[model samples]
Target chain A: MAETTDLDVAYVARLARLQVSDDERRTFQAQLGDVLRYAAKLAEVNVQDVEAAAHAVPMFNVFREDRPRDWFTADEALQNAPRSANDLFIVTKVVE
Target chain B: MTAAELPALTISELQPLLRGGAVSPGEVVDALQSRISEIEPQIDAYIALDFEAAKHEANAADLSLPLGGIPIAVKDIISVAGQRCTCASRSLSNYIAPYDATLIRKLKAAGAIPLGRTNMDEFAMGSSTENSSVKITLNPWDKSRVPGGSSGGSAAAVAAGAAFGALGTDTGGSIRQPAAFCGIVGLKPSYGRVSRFGVVAFASSLDQAGPLTKTTRDAALLMNAIAGVDPQDSTSLPEPVPDYTQLLGREIRGIRIGLPKEYTTDGIDPQVKAAVDAAVTQLQALGAEISELSLPHTEYAVAVYYVLATAEASANLARFDGVRYGHRTEGVANLVEHYERTRAEGFGAEVKRRIILGTYVLSSGYYDAFYLRAQKVRELIRRDFVEAFKKVDLLISPTSPVPAFKIGERTADPLQMYLADIFTIAANLAGICAISLPCGFATSESGTQLPVGLQLLASSLDEARLLQVAHAFEQSTDWHQRRPPL
Candidate 1:
């Protein structure tokens, strides 16, 4: 496990698109450090020959006839948008 | 049953009454509404109750259907069209669901009324409902203690007679742990057994929605309504659905039940261990064979779960940016700042902690060490179950290491709280079916009785046997009939 001091909490939080307060950063750094340290126990297991399993049950690709089906209308889709104009979700200006 | 007593009856009990014209569906809703009004203030089990809508549905309920007119509370995380799908988070506090989750759609199709939205940990993140951005759901047994969470509110409502039965989602013990703490039955079907469509994702690989109910039979009845393949959820198994209640009265004369030694180690509460041991003896008396077995990889389950579940959560929750449905921030300089500030202000401490940890593990420098390693260990955990089931029909243990702890007790220490779910996480990791039912009760430090849960785990798609055994044990004991002082 990486040392607790080694985790750049602010940088990771930014990567996660979260803005943590200084207090939150300090608190999460300690709490998450402990969690990661505990999780480090996984390294002791001999997984050299074991293949990683993403889903416990084996999955196969499912297919259906290529056809459209009834779904939410445009108005219904944008009904929950925090900000919308016409049928589009309004957002902060981009590509400035 | 009189109107005053209607709210306390289980779905199985009320079904006949509703069918016989002895109790109208409208009356059931009225009785439940009154009962909810009386108990909800103390328990805070519900986030929102829509009596007007529920009554309308009840009045038109098709009595011929299985769950007709039965009112089931829903965890706020699952979408119920036109109801608030807050997920007990401030981010979606004003967000009403535009569509019903597939599970909700199935329940309604079976004639069940979606009665109220129950509180939960923010995005179903915490073991105790203390992390809920809304109000804390208090244990019905003792208000000083918490109802186990993120399905805490659903479990509490069922326990306190605020609702007959409720829907809960289990990612890492969310349903079963709370059900254990509240002294009810909670089932986590084999991962693909239930549809996850429209249910807010926590850890997609781990999450499965199931029932929290007053009796195993009610759980089976709910399971019958909800479990099936859904084209909407690609991971939903294409396996045929069974009559989960068919094995309720079947004999278990030669069924092999394994008791994993690791689950009974020193960290468990003495009384909890005693109760589970007694339950094992009772199952033996009922003609089941009990044996001690090892699931050596057991200790690493919570470790692997936290890593994988949080990793998935960090990705799943990315959709909650300010541009869309949930909470948005004002006065942000740019889109990036808006996303950061919105999430920062919206999520609770535990959610933030998990997101950060998840982000760190998946980040460039640590992916192979943390995320990949956890998945491989997760496979080992899954293999442990696969190997154990070869010799035993089911595995039994205490659902939680201890009963419901007092509210605010473990909130400050996240790791301590994480460890509380140690016994229940492995089932999710293995993607197997499991259930928790009230095996017995233990007196707390203050002498109040708290429920102890007996967990039963079966191989993937073995819910029929799981329900059969749980029902047999439940019927053999008075634990399920014991009501809280409330």
Candidate 2:
């Protein structure tokens, strides 16, 4: 078994942009550690020369005609937004 | 027609009656509504029921269309115009979809009335419906036990005869496991077989929407309506859609079936094993050549799935920041806090854990160690199936190791819960199509009879052959005829 190190729980949570409570962080650290340790069993497999497979069936660059088409009206598009202003989604201020 | 009789009719049985003018669509919807009224309280099978809209749609339904006014329950993850597509998460609890998903558009175009949105694991996350923020969907067979999830409600609804058939999204056995636990037929079409234009993404690469129905024929009818290339979804297959229903009565005399030795390990429930073994005997009697094969890398499937699926989920879910749509945090000072608080409040524990784990794996130093290694092992796993298929026409296994446990049985241990999908996740990883149907009944400790699922997997886009063999087995057996007592 690869000697596992304690996951930097806080740093990882922040990177995911999730505000996990301190209690949740502690609980998750142990739980996530268990999952990762179990997942470490993958190292036992000799995949030395195998190519990585991403999507199941190999199809790529699935493009369509580059032409304008009908789409959601501005009202329809912004209907689900928590807050909207003049058909634009409103969000917390990000700039000065 | 009485509510008692409505829950017992399959889509094929109802279609002729509907076409012959023996029943109006309103009466059909009313019969189903009555059944839903009788059972929904006990099963908790739906997130939102649109009786008025369903009746209105039914009244105006074109009986000349393929679906012929059949009412189908949709998983809350799939959008239906003007209906709430909650995905069973509080974040989108109040979010009503403005337009229909591609599947919904096809179903509606085929004259299928969308009756209601069913419950599921929050954002299609967990194996059991317990993850839903909406309500717990109980197994129609035994209320104390759970309906398998993240498509639990759809399975339970169909099992309870609340809907003739339903739609479900399978990421990692979400549709099949629940269908097994609920004693229904669930098909997870090959990755690109069904379009995912508006279905909420859990793991983009693994997610495919399919059907949960009482019989294989019903699943096939649904496939005919919904399985087609959609220009809106880039990953949708370009292959011409076939009439899947035409192959139902076809012969399966010389089909080669592979029984992976890895799937028959000791951890499987004895009853489930016996049932699948019995199913193999039945298939053999029908002239299918059954042979034991090895998917040697099977042991790594769950581990690889978690690594890759979570990585994809972490990235896919990033779109749910508190900005555009979904739930947003209030009183946030800055962008960072807004994103943090919104996600913290919006997502469930399992979703958060997966996101964090996904982030950890895809993080800078550990990418090669965890994510890359898993991807490489995934290739080996896929190659194992490729080699096995060279010798066999299809692979069969028990859908879940055990039947449905109590709702809280595996909640404390995420790893234990993840193992619930040990048998079903590989098909999703390999991007192949698979189906689960009731094999037999196993009595629980309390003498409650639970259903076991037998799974059949086929190579990518081979649903025609997959459905044909499954339909033969289903017609030869009485398992699909059994209904849950709600």
TM-score of chain A of each: 0.91, 0.89
Top candidate when judged by TM-score against the true structure? 1
- Candidate 1 per-residue lDDT, tens place, B15-73, comes to 99999999899999999999999999999999999999999998899999999999999
Error of 1 at B438 (Å): 0.6
- Fnat, model by model in order, equals 0.88, 0.85
Docking class of 1: high
Which is the leading candidate under DockQ?
Answer: 1
lDDT of 2 by residue, A14-52 (tens): 999999898999899888989999999988989888888
Instruction: State the DockQ of every prediction.
Output: 0.85, 0.78
Clashes of 2: 0
Rate residue B202 of model 1 by lDDT.
Answer: 97
